[model samples]
Target: MSKTRNPNLDVIRCLAVLLVIVIHFFLNTKFYDVTINSWQLEIMVGMRTICMICVPLFMCLTGYLMHEKELSWEFYHKLWPTLSVYLQSSALIYLARIGIFRERLSLADGVLGIFSYSTAPYAWYVEMYIGLYLLIPFLNMIWQGCQTRGQHQLLVATFVILCILPTFLNIFGKMIPDYWVTLYPLAYYFSGAYIHTYETEVTQIPLRLVTLMIVLLSVMHNLNASAGRIFQWLPMNDFGSSEIYALTIVIFVGILKARLPKTIGDIAKYIAPYTFAMYLVSYIGDQLIYPIFMNWFKTESAMLAWMAVPILLIFIGSLLLAIAQKLFWQLLRVCLDKFWQKYQVL
Candidate 1:
């Protein structure tokens, strides 16, 4: 039997994807004539900055769920679908872009892109996930070897110091050695596992306090981005390293602790199954629809209302697409199951 779904994790996944959509909507698109000093600009920018947590949160969720799973045929069986989606989405996106540009599709580039180490736009998350998928067994082995919670916490802390901290220091013009590139996804991945395994009710940080810190840090990040953009000469501390990851952990913890109403839990279950497909749908919209929307709405004279319309449209449209895909997949799965049952030896 399939494992029971965790409602909290499902809620977190939906929230993360929605946050990502918000970021894509406003990150480059100009918002309604708002100057750097405007309150609206700060809110928009701050929210975008804060929502950067979504990516790391995705990594965290992966670690939480998969870190303990054995590296066996069963693991690959689960992992293959994600790999297939990445390949399919990248190809579909390339095709869509070429068609939009009215350019000839280069067959060689399309095939090569499947194997390319370089990340396609908005597809970097999948690339990182692929890397982590390969290493999860070894990672779990190491986690299993830890005799005490303190040891696991210590290892995660060491990664934060040696690998994660330098990312923050980069804002101050400090650079770490190049070899440290091997550490990342590792830092976030193991930290997620550590949080899941070692963090307990007794050790839990208060959600209220974490929420307050997220707001305060978001304001700071917003200010940093604004100053860099407005002054032109100042550095933007846009590294988004520590604060993003920190907020992600808090959010994960908060979700873990939440007891949602039955109504919300049902809704989460309904939507959660389509989230991966929604991500792919939203990404295509990000590439294709966003530019078109920007052309019509990105004027200095545009109202804040107008600025919001595209985000709403893209989000809703992606959901509709996800729903349709979910229905289609359900049908396809039924057919496949019937075929297998008829053909296979019991």
Candidate 2:
């Protein structure tokens, strides 16, 4: 039998998807171009910093949930659903570009766009995830080999040093060689495995403390952005820095520790499965909604004031598209199965 779903993990998945939408807000708005002169802009910067944890949260959740997966044909076959959704979403986005945006392209270019993720640029995560999914079984083998908690801790620490520290240290005169920093996904994966291994101990961490750490990290990220603006040598933002790593851990733990109501938990569980689809189709919603809002509001700051509505509209629109896509695929599979069974009988 399949393992029961953990509502807490579901909630984390939901939160991760929402944060993904929130981060895209910056891209859709003039937040990047506007000068950070007012408190409104500063708040937006702080929110952007917090939302940067979106991708890490998803990566860590993968490690936490899939830590025990073994190498097998059955395990590898699970990737088909994700790949199917990605292809369908890409096709939908391409169609939208052609029909809604009136963008013209040859049939070959459209096919190539889906494969290359040019149709839905946000499907880049899907591309990254395909490689990571292939490696998970081997990754779990390494995890299962660890004889003790200390070994697991050492493994996580080593990853941090290799994947996270370089991006952080390189900020100041390239103090650390960052050639291995792209391996940060492995760092998050192992970290999630460690958390899963020690859930009892991790849950004991105070929720208040986790909140405090998140707040501090946001402040530091905001300051970092400000400093980068003041000094040309520094980066304007730290989207995938050690700060995001730390914040993702704290937020993940905090959500796990909190006592969510039954109704809220159930809602999260229902929404969680749809989140991957939502992320893929969100580009459609963004393209549809942002332009209208941008035209309505004169400044990025003005749009920020009424941001909640546009965000909600985009979320709802994307969720509807994802649900429709899911239904379409389900029906297709049913039809294919019926035809195969009839042919076999004949």
RMSD to native for every prediction? 4.3, 2.4
TM-score for model 1? 0.82
> What tens digits encode model 2's per-residue C-alpha lDDT throughout 203-250?
897767767776676566566557435311122234456778888898
What is the C-alpha lDDT profile of model 1 across 217-329, one tens digit per residue?
75686576565355111222222256666777777888888889978888877777667666766765776566777677654345345656766677777778667655666
TM-score of each: 0.82, 0.92
RMSD of candidate 2 to true structure, Å: 2.4
Superposed by TM-score, candidate 2 places the C-alpha of residue 261 at a distance from the truth, in angstroms, of 0.5
Clashes of each: 0, 0
Local distance difference test, per candidate?
Answer: 0.69, 0.83
